[model samples]
Every structure is written in C-alpha cells, then in structure tokens.
Target: MSHTANKDALAQGTHHLIIDGIEQYYHVMGEGPVCIVHSGGPGVRWDYLRMPLIEAFLKLIYLEPIGTGASGRLADPRGYTLARYTRHVDALIDHLAVGTVYFLGHSHGGFVGLRYALDHLQRLSGLILYDTSPTTGPEFGQSIEEALQRFAARHSIRPEVPKLLAAVRRVFAAEAQAAATDEDATRELQQIFPVYFADYWGREREFAPLRESVWAWSDPLRGQEPEPYDVRGELGRIAARTLVLAGQEDAICVPSWAQVLHAGLPVSQLVVLPHSGHFGHLEEPHAFASAVRNFVS
Candidate 1:
C-alpha cells in the first residue's frame, strides 16, 4: 500500500501511516533523501529527536512506536518484542516505498534499527545509532548503580531517591520478564528520568522543549524484551556506514557500551558527546547535528 500521505494530496506534509490495520503516525521534516529516525522509548515520544539542524542536511522521517504519539495501541503487550518492532519498521518502509532508507534510531529505537540492518541489510543504505547499546548485561545494570552511588556521594541526592531508583530497576526487570505493559511501571520510569541526563536538575531548562510535548509510555514493547539484549555476536552483520554517537556521561547506555558497540561494527565511527547523557542530541544539538550531517554528506 502507498503511504497514507498519498491517500489524499491534502495529506502531504502530514506525518501518519496505516500499519497492520492501525493508523500510525510519524513526522516528516526537511528536504532531500529520507533518513528514518526511531525515537528512544519502548514508549517515548518522537518529538525529542526532531532536530531541525539535522533536517537541513538530510530529510528526516521520525516514527512513533505503538502506544505513543499518534501511533496505534497494541492489542497485546507481548507483540512489543524486538523482532516485532523491527517488523513494524519494515512494514513502514514498504508502505512508504522509500527504497534503501538511511535508518537512524535512538536508545531502544537503535536496537530496532540494528536488528533491521542485520536481517534486511539490503534495504538500508546507512545506519545511525544514538546513545544505544549492543547488549544489556549485568554489567550495564551494575554500572548504573555505581554511577548513582557515586553521584550521591558528591551531590547528596535525596535518600528517598535511592529507594525510588531501586524500584525503577525492579519495575524494568519485572516487566522485561513478563513481557507486558503497566502504566505503573511507566510512572516509575518518568519518576527517575533525571538519571538519564548529565545535569537533570541543574540543566532543567535544556529539556524545556520536551516538557510541553506529550511524553507517553506504553508497557508492551520495551519492558518486554524477552531475552537479555545481546547483539554483540551479530554486530558484524551490519554493513552500512554506521555512525555511533554516545554521551560521555550516559549512565544508562554508558560510553563503555558505545565503545564496544562501535568496535564491533566493521565500518563505524564513534563520537562521544563529551558532556551529555542519554539525550546527547539535545545537550549538544549543534555538534550532534553536525556529526550527522558530516556523516551522511
């Protein structure tokens, strides 16, 4: 089927698509070749990655994963598996008839993008991984704990916050094992979202733009990643010109994981955002957009 925009000429510039009987929404911005962007969030909003700077260099197609933004809700949380998301992207690619798209995914979206390249490498011309990991090991979890502890030692974070942090991880682990969605789990995630930024409290305004945007959470896909996300063995399967961007202080995806993720891709360049966290693109928009522009051009 042709992309929804084709259904009506008036629909041009509107970001919406019908995938698998549900109407899904994705924003289309800028001009030139398409660079499909997958926003982070097993259920996060796509508005965060709408970087005009990058759009100036390459056309950007941002996807709203199920349960968030204008996308349809999944009937079954179990359907939120990594493979399922990869397929959603595949269907979107076909539905749009945009050949050999340049895929860019952030956080969880990066995982899906990497998976897509592994099986459908022929359909991808290049790949961009922003603040993501190749695998989720006990080490990554431990590192987050350690970082929190270290941060506490210096900043004296509220005592109750630590308990909340533990609860956050528990919620994540539980949902991952069950492969389901829970609004309660999502609330817990938003509660400790600050841990994602280098200066969550101090640099509050830096995230102001997103403050007004609708940040929705779905319990199905992200938390329900059935297995430990270990794509290390399959990294070599990606053959596109890959650009790996990591935040130097990213506690969640961590720079160390990015280092190894970069090392595994045969053709890849790693750019560590010297002073940013998971939302490195926001923290360093100019540099971030320039990196993307330089790579694609």
Candidate 2:
C-alpha cells in the first residue's frame, strides 16, 4: 500500500494485515520518512508510546503488536517472543512497501527492535532504542532494584510510596510466575506507575492520566525463555546508525543500561533526558522529539 493509503487506514483508527495467520495491527501518523515504532511490554498496550511530537516530522507507524490491543492473540500467550515480534516487524515493513524505514523501539519493544535490526539490518535506515537495555538477568535486575530503592528513598515522605513499592514487588513476583491476569496486571501497573517517573507526584496533573490509562495482560511464557535475554556480544554486528535514548531517572531501564547500549553500538548517540524517567517521551516530549528528529534527519 502507498503512504496515502496507510494514512487513510490510520484515519479510521488502525491498519492491520494478516501475518503468519494472525492479525498485526498498527497506527500511522505524521508525514516524512516512515518510522516504525514498537511499544514496550511483553503485554503492555501500545498507547503509552504514542509520540505526537515525532509524528510532526516523521511518518510514525506504531504497532499494536500481537497479543496486545486490537491485534490477534497467540494460540498460546507464551508464544509472544522476540522472534515472533521481529517477524511481525519484518512483515509490517514488507506490507508498508516502505523499504529501509527508521525503526524505534521502547523498553521491551527495544528488545524487539534490536532483534529485528540484528536479523534484518539491510531493511533499516536507522534505529532508536529508547528506555531499553542490552540484557535482562541478574545485573539488570540489580540495577532496577537499586533504582527502585533510590525512588523509594526519594519519595519516602509521600504517604503512598510504600503501597506503590509493594505493588512493584507484587507485579514483579507475578511476572516471574507468569500468573497475573490482564485485569490484575493492568491494575498493578497503574498503581506502581509513579515509580516510573522522575517526579510523578510533582507532576501528577500532567502524568496521572497515563498512569490511569495504562493497560497490560499476562503472557505465561514471558521471562521464561530458556536463556536470559542478552545481546551484548551481538551488538557489534548492527551497522545501522542508532539513537540510544534514555531517561536520566528511569528506574526500569536506567541510564547505565543506555550507556551500555551506546558503548556497544558502533555508530550511536546517547541522549539522556535529565528530568524524566522511563516515559521520557511523555515527561520531556520536546527533548525526546528533538533527539529523534535529529537522529532520523
């Protein structure tokens, strides 16, 4: 389909195509070089990654991704792996007929983007790894734990800090067991969202809507891969120029993780949004958009 057709399809809500016997839905906005965006969460909904600012300068293609939002579910939710997500990206590029597009991934979506780039480097013009890390295991967990401790310490004065921290523990525990239901995951994610911000309480008026609006589901297979997710050894192979964006105070994907990615990727730039957390695109929209715009341009 042509770019015009893609826009028209998005105008109605979202555009989708059948890939590997499943529906792959995506949202397109703005106009310029086509940039395909993959939101985070093995189960989090895609709305949280919407970049209206970046849309002003690029044709943003946001994937709903399998097992999320309006997209088709897998026969087994555990089937939502990076490989599967990468295949959908490959197909989406082919379906869009926009060869060598810019690819952006946030959080878990960054993992998907990295897999796609490593597997299909020839199909990409550039890559943006936002709020993501190069690996997930003990080290990553340690960093997150440290970050969370800092967050708790920083916000300890607030009456709600303890509950938020409790929710974080509960969610992580549930994720480890792959036992959370969609409703349960969604509620826990919302309750603990303040931990994701540099100052969510300070800016509750601006960020609360996103906290309340967040949605998630459980993927029984998630985090159960035989091997821990690590691509440090493979990062050298990705020749596409990359923008490694991170939030300075991000608890989940800390600046240290972004630094690791920046150090590994040969041709890359690192931009850490100073006053933001995991959701820099929302907390520091202008900086996030400018970094992306400059990188793509």
Clashing pairs in 1: 181-219
lDDT tens digits, residue span 1-297, model 2: 343333444352478899989998888788788888998877789988888899898988889988888898887765777888899998888777765899999999899889998999998999999999999878887788789898988888899888777777766552456545788778777878888899998999988888888888776235345467899999999999999999999999999999999999999999999999999998999999999888887
lDDT computed for candidate 1: 0.75
RMSD of 2: 2.3
Q: Best-fitting candidate, measured by lDDT? A: 2
lDDT, candidate 2, at 8: 48
List the candidate 1 regions with Cα displacement exceeding 4 Å: 1-12, 157-164, 173-186, 208-214, 221-226
Which portions of model 2 miss their true places by more than 4 Å?
1-13, 173-175, 220-226
Lowest lDDT 10-residue stretch of candidate 2: 1-10
Q: What is the C-alpha lDDT of each candidate?
A: 0.75, 0.85
TM-score (C-alpha, index-matched) for candidate 1: 0.86
lDDT string for model 1 (107-133, tens) is 889889889999899888789999988
